[model samples]
Target: MRGLRKVVTVVDEVLRDVGRPVPVPVRRVAVAAVVRNPWAGRGFVTDLQPEVEALAPELARLLTGRLIETLGGVERIEAFGKAAVVGLDGEIEHGGALIHTPYFGNVLRELTEGTSIIVFSDDRLPAGEPLTVPLWHKTAAATRSHYQTVQIRVPDAPRPDELVVIAGAASGPRPHARIGDRRTDPVVRLADLEKLENAR
Candidate 1:
């Protein structure tokens, strides 16, 4: 069995900054951990559930705090959406891997009436294979990627059952990027996540 290497963890909160008497805030908190490929050189993460579970709340707090601060110290999120991007690197054939949650649809429904979730993977598919996905119930399918990043957004309500996921097989070495500029971390601007998410 191959051992796993926990590499990096990141937390980010994105919100809308509308200048008004009482501005409306839309925020999403994301916490992600990058780990060494277990199967690399002949190993893979055998038990990743525990790590993923432990990461959820911490990410929520970090991202939530940023959201609150952006909205001027708000305590609760009234209307919010959430997402997770997975960066995977590896090589595999057929029936690769997948990333999904049990109640993501329920949460998305609550956040946005007509929410659209997106996933990006850098899988080496056959000529006619699709690279991206909407990640809705009806169109749910496995995604393959390697050292590539896929962004998936789901509409979610203020319920406590919202789930996020990152799945699929990747090839080659994983791609990595620094989260944000140090100056921007203290004071988050729209260019951070909005630009990246929209650009995807």
Candidate 2:
């Protein structure tokens, strides 16, 4: 929690869709922590591993805990993702260093009992700019119904020498998802297409 500035959490619930009541509301939550960037103002310092080791795991645990609590529990988390935004004075890689490594992502994965790799996004932006965190099914990456996103922003954060790290979760798939998953969708191989062309 070193150099921590503030924590922000947002919850979005979809209770109705197309003017119809949904049986189970879809809930998406995002937790973000604005922290001072350790590398900020240090021009081109080579190795980030030491600070990454020192910070990522604890940050991950804190954010993930907040996300799970806001969502009710780990069982409520069916989809998950992460994101980070670095302030203007910081490198985009500074944000990437915190959230991209296993030290950060694996904590969420382990706590949620998720099998699929957690999806993510990272960028450099000014304070108060909104960022969208992309999410997918926690256990099945190809589960199209669970593809979702949560947008988060802090009005005053990442002040030129800081990073906003985020974790996102969804309680369920999109309300009334009708599209089938990738596993059941028909596959079109390039070889088959070539054979068809030759026959034509």
Candidate 3:
């Protein structure tokens, strides 16, 4: 199927005036597309690989370019993520088809040189709804400041026969990150039930 009916982009900049020793600022952006759902309302299709292979790279290229443009350049980006929202007529896997493969991440990793995995969100939604795309530091998952989300809302998209696919980027981590990464830091770990409750 020839995919990509439309593309949408959103960017947000946040600033903290007094949350830390010095003021903090951040930039986050997302690029999403509304495309014809190749499998929607169709009977069981055993092989979805061809469709996936055909679409993943193109979507990755388009989104990554937009992300670079939004952030001024690829060098300015520190975190990355992706997401998709399928139309009512489509299956959840339709959304997954677009964002789950390394074919997609390969583009982001090559361009951004992001070592850590890309976070994601995929769900079925109607037109004019919000899709929250999660973000994380490229190589430093333990860095608290890089965890973020890009929320995109298309006024009239992902119509019954469509899917909303997305990619995202961030200039830095959270403004005031007191917590550490659960993946690397020992402090951010499992705690005894008694100690956890006592602190609360």
- On lDDT, the leading prediction is 2
- 1 or 2: which has the higher TM-score? 2
List model 3 lDDT by residue over 8-117, tens digit each: 88988887546544255788999987789888777677788888888888888888989999899988999999898889888888878778887887777788878887
Per-model tally of clashing residue pairs? 22, 0, 4
Task: Note the Cα lDDT for every prediction shown.
Answer: 0.30, 0.92, 0.83
> Which run of 10 residues does model 1 get worst, by summed lDDT?
138-147
Residue 1 local lDDT, model 3: 26
Sorted on TM-score, highest at the top, how do the candidates line up?
A: 2, 3, 1
Candidates 2 and 3 compared: the better one by TM-score is: 2
Stretches > 4 Å off in candidate 1:
1-43, 90-200
Pairs with steric clashes in candidate 3? 116-138, 145-173, 145-174, 146-173
lDDT (10s digit) by residue, model 1, range 1-200: 11212212222232322333213222222222222332334345554445334443344344434444443444332223333332223433111222233233333333223233423233332222222322221121111211133233322211121222222211111223235333345655788879779999
